[model samples]
Target: MHLTLGLHRAVRHEPSSVATFYEGRTHTFRQLADRVARLAGALRTIGVKTGDRVAILALNSDRYIEYYLAVWWAGAVVNPINTRWATPEILYSLDDSQSEVMFVDSAHKSKIDELREGSTTLEHIIYLDEEEKPNGTLSYEDLIEDGEPIEDSYRHGDDIAGIFYTGGTTGFPKGVMLSHTNIGVPAMTFLCEEYGFGSVSLHTAPLFHVAPLMYVIAQLFNGGRHIVLSGFEPAQVARAIEERKVTDVLLVPSMLHVLLDSPVVQKTNFSGLRRIWYGGSPIAETTQRRALEVFQPSGLVQLYGLTEIPVVALLSAAWHAPEMRKLRSTGRAAQENEIMIADANGREVPRGSIGEIVARGPNVMKGYWNKPVETETAIRNGWLWTGDAGYMDDDGFVFIADRFKDMIVTGGENVYAAEVENAIAKHPAVAACSVIGIPSHEWGESVHAVVVLKPGAREFTVEEIRHHCKDLIGGYKSPRSIEFKPSLPLSAFGKVVKDELRAPFWRDAIRKV
Candidate 1:
């Protein structure tokens, strides 16, 4: 089925129902559909043909949702730019995708000239702001006002729907090409399982990310209301939840951490919230415990997946209970997805044996855009080999150990950074920490840790940390070196950037992982 089918259904059955809520403004499904059709007509007028790429660089808003449906309605591909990326990274994606028309919001308008100057193919720039149009850009309102409403293009099944760019922590970002079925199927499955009709969902996470996009799609499938925020701020999220009576919301672990610590969140009434969906990175046990205490009424659900294969597995709300034993696991694979632990030769590993986590399902992307060799390497024998190191138990619970590339080898023994980081995070003094392998003459590679202490916590020494970890993990897994930092570098999705931590230590090494 077409991804835009949900929009059509919503407009047909609930045309007068509220579709979106943004900063005190509301739009009904009828209004949203009318604007979407007009925007599609406007895009077509500007030479956006079937399969052509249209990119949006904007924050979360009603207009952003309109941009998505309008692009699909225009028979074009949606390429949402990562809002946190640098100019060079953004330029690379636009140039690589050969996107012709770009949409810029007020927040990013200052960089428009530079982006346009650096682009070789970008032709038109549409301004999506409340103010008057910029000198060289077309007004978003003008397009909707002047253009005529058009019918849906009906792009379905294998038609390329989106080109989501992964955060390039190790190197340049590659665009993951997803088809309409690739995204729509999983969305429908998720909606059937979790969300009910007319649920009120909040869009606090960046819409550029696939996780939020999937949630948005699920809401659309259920004919639910969307409550959008420009960006994730703890105060604003809490306010939106209480004021909008938001039933469900998605957040990364980092955002959850900030929310749990915010005084505004503590003061806000969380009784209206029914679920808190979090993922993108592992949640520390301490942070999870605090979250459970802060949002007592809301059930927490953890999701695990990548841009290539969205929504592979989900740790259900039952597992988030304080007494649950499977809290450390990312959770079993979703019903629609098939996951397995594979050895280097693409052989399935024994139960409880750690190996590369591979997944196969309709949700898997077609391939990486313009990167044939990388696509071949990623998807072999119809399975998307996620570079995550993990294992499944006899009962089918999946525990993610670490990224295969992030594994630390010391004296021929494998040490997963996540294991050591988990141990360090248990300490009351520790707020955040990241483990990496550094060049070691004695052991080829040694475990090193960078730690961020909780505010007003006493200073901790390397020996103290090693002693603390010795009781929890193997002696070899203990961090040999420790450095205190206020914070660790994070990717757009909140995963620790291990490459940055290893850069100085491996600067003179013969090889870098």
Candidate 2:
């Protein structure tokens, strides 16, 4: 189940096809394989060994593609640093993973000196810029110059592949030990599904993020070309889709929303795009329907999965069901895994009953790196308790109520803040919204909504908006108060930072400690 079996298969079938496109350069499988081998050999020369950790701090570039195969070829663990993370978080992950070598792109070169200084496990830093290489860090090109194509250190399966870091309740990043098999589950799902495959996939999501990386790995296995961009900009995405005749894309709700509203998006050609997998947040039905009208059948699918167990469920184009177009449902258990909604005690809940959503599958993370207790708490009885609150319909479709952590308990009733937020978001003027629980004197915890208004809207009061929401949802579910902001804080993948939203209120609060 190692990547080579697939890599060698790809090389034999189509060696000359463009596998990666970045910075106006295309890399064929033959060339990529060669580079990966030589880089792995060079890493070995630098004393990298099996189970050793190598980290990559990069933007979406050709070297980033090489980073994946090279680390796996050397049988070393990969820890991809989040571009959005601050230095302290990045330092924490590097220290925790015990990474020996780190590849920092030109964009992050300035921080390399500081990051490397405090990392006891880090032995070397390689700068990955095509033209300019920093002085202190070794050049990526120099290291690969005519290095021997060393034999692969080991084949893959349950072996450690990547130390993928995701946010935690502890407020520190936890490295999720994702094996080759773990990634392969999502890779195989898209490949075998017969829908997600294409000649080109618009790589708008960051490659370091596991949710997006799942598609990148799948594209490689399927011989599809990846069109990489430095970052997500609506103009770039629209232009790339037209220029490359891009056929599929994985986009967050924010990007999708921005693109749909951009003039370039409407004017630019998108005749070739066959699939658009929108996720990373609860997409409003109004927006989902508008997308379908714009792109037709190609504008299909609303997939739901977290980095922890990314293969939660997939909604096919057929299920887009123009009529129903249910926006917030996360779909059902993926064909490869079981998704269960259980009570706090972990007993399975019946259909249509709301509870905590958990999953068990080959795709689940092995554990949090070096934190057995945290691992045990997350993956009890081989099930990855996702901490999302959702329920199954008789049709087996999973409907997400809200995250268990995001569920606001006000007074005695458990109010799903998402229901209230949905009511608020559906308003014509509301562009984006996040629901949170703020401290309250009477209710103990009162529902609060932080909202962003669309451009061109006139000033509106919070009471006016709260009154509009009460018309749709129950009064109790309506936000006790609304906070206006230009935009909600978002992660690189565009997930709302609920933790950051509540940080001020929670500064001295003891929550489940």
Candidate 3:
């Protein structure tokens, strides 16, 4: 089915139902469909033909959703930009994707001219805000107001739907090309699950990210209410949930903690909330327990996947109980996905053996845009090789150990950073921590930790941390050295940027990530 099929279905089934709630403004399905069709005409008027690349560089908003549907409505491909990226990184992606038309908000408008100058293919910029149109750019409202409605182009199945760029933690980001089938299969399967129909789903996570973007499609299919926040703020999210009676929301572990700690949550009634979907990183047991306390009635679901394959496995709410042994696992593979642990040679390994997580299904992405070599390297024999090192238990629950690159080899014994981080995080004084391999003349490489202490907590010595970890893990797995910081460096999606943490220590090392 086409990506736009959900929009058409929603319009047909509930034209007058509220489609989106954003910043005190509301739009019905009818209104959304009308604007999308007209915007599609506007895109065509500006020379956007079928298969043309159109990009949007803005935070979550009603207009962002419209941009996605309208682009697909015009039979064009959507390239959603990461709002947190640097100008140079943004320019690189624009040039690489050959995106000629871009939609820019006031927050990023100042860099428009420089981006245009730097990119070889970018030509037009649409001012995406309600404020006065910037000089030399087309106004978003004017385009929809004046342009005539157009027919749906019906791009479907293997047709390329969207190109989402990954965070360049290692180096430059690659554009992950996802087809309509890649999204639709999983979305259709979601309907069979507990994602409530006609539910009020809040979109606070950046819509550019694949996880939230997939929720958008899923909500469309369910003809549910979309509550769009400008971005994630603890108070705003708490208020939206209480005021709008939001039924479900998606958050990363970091966002979840902030939301739980927010003072607004104390006043908010969470009885209306049915689900709390979180992914992007594993949640600490402490955080999970706290979350269960705050949203007692809501189901906490864990999603696991990369941008290339959006839903490889889903840990349902039932597995999140404090006493459940599967709480740490990502849960079994989803209904339509086939997941396995594979070695470097692409051979499936025995259960409980750590290897690269490989997944295969209709939901797998088409390939990386314009990178055949990398595409071949990622997907072999119909399985997408997710660089995560993980294992499956006898019950088929998949447990992610760490990223293969993040695994530290000290004294010829392998150490997974995640295992060490979990132990460090358990220390009462530790707020957050990351483990990496640092060069050591004696052992060739030593496990090192960067930690952030809890606010107002007393400082502790490195020996205290190592002694604490030694009780839980092997001496080799304990951090050899410790550095205290106010905060850890994180990518836009909330994963710790290990490359930046390793750069200083590996500057002159023979091996580098």
Candidate 4:
């Protein structure tokens, strides 16, 4: 079955049920299905044929959800642009993916003029806003009203559904080709394992990212209601949860920290919240413990994976108890996937040994779009080599250490940045921190940290930080240098951009790892 099948089932099973909530408006399943079908027909009228690429650059909204379903219903592929990307990055993705039709919401309409000038393949621009149509663009609402409903394309199994781009940090973004099965199967598995029918799921995370998109699919599969927010703000999220009685939400660790810290959260009612899923980066133990205290009724679930392979493992709610020592782990392999730690030679490593994380399953992407060599290097013998360093315990729990590229070699010893960052996070004054290796004449490379202190926190000296870290980690692993900033640079999904932190120090280093 394809993704659209869920929509069809929802329409048949519960046509009168509320399907989506945006702002102060609500849409029933029947109305949503009709809009989706008409939007698909409208897309066809605009020359979107099967296998064509249609891109959307918008904040999270009901329109964004419609954009996803309509594109697939029309038998076209989706290329969701990262909302955090600048003009150059946006242009590169549009040109690289060869997207023909573009959708822009009111918030991002300004970029359309600039994007239109640089994009050669973007032929049609559809405005997704309630205001008057922009010059040279068709209104999204008009398309649904004027066009006729179309039949489902029934694109199933290996048919490509979307081309998700990755690697904007290191270099050019490569479109990772994900098929209908690659996404749908895993989403269904997650739905059965974690979600329940008629649940209310909140969409505050960016839809451009794979994790949130997967959550969207899971909600659809379970016939759950969706409450879409334009973007993530801690206060807004808390307000939405209290008002809408949202059952589940998917947030990165950074977003969780902000939400837990927000005073609005303490006053908001979390009685309806069932689960809070977090991932994209390792969360500090201190933050996790505090989260447990604040969100008492809500279970915290940790998901671990990359765009290439959506979710390889999950730390379930059962493993998140405060008393559980395994809370630090990324958890065991997901039921639908297999995870293994492999050395550089592609040989499996023993438990408790650090190595690259490799996964094999139906959830793995087909390959990198238009890059056969890179695809070959990434996947071998049916296993996708995730460039993440981690170790498995004897009981089969996986603990992520760091990304392969983020490993810091200081004085000939390996220092995983996550470990150092976790130690720094334990310091009460620190709100957020990122650890990286910097060039040093004496040590070859020295451990350096960029920290963001909690608001109104007293100033901390480098020596104080070093001493505090010494108590948690090895003295050698303590950061030799510390720089404080008001905030850290985060990606659309809330993962810290370590490469950005490492760039200035390594500009003349001939190579960046």
lDDT for each residue of candidate 4 in 357-416, tens digit (9 for 90 to 100): 899999899999898888998899999998778899998998876566656654324466
TM-score of each: 0.81, 0.80, 0.81, 0.81
Residue-level lDDT tens digits of model 1 in 445-501: 678999998999987888899888765565767889989998999999998888798
lDDT of 2: 0.77
Q: lDDT of each structure?
A: 0.84, 0.77, 0.84, 0.84
lDDT of 3 by residue, 1-513 (tens): 888887899989999999998988899999999999999999999999999999999988999999999999999999998775556668878989999999999988888888878899998999999899878899999999999999999999999999988633234567899999898788765565688777999999888888888888889999999999988898889888989999989887768877877888888888999999887654565677889988997989888877889889988898888778887788889888999899889888999898989999998989988888889988899999988888999999998766655566554344668768877888998899998987664354678999999999987877888788764555656888889889999999999998899889878743342
Better of 2 and 3 by lDDT: 3
**Deviating ranges (above 4 Å) for candidate 3:** 168-170, 406-513
lDDT of 3 at 57: 93
lDDT per residue as tens, model 2, 78-184: 88987755566678888888887999987887887788787878889988886677666787888888578887766578998888876555445568889888888
How many pairs collide in each candidate, listed in order? 0, 1, 0, 0
Relative to the true structure, candidate 4 reaches a TM of 0.81
What is the alpha-carbon lDDT for the whole of candidate 3?
A: 0.84
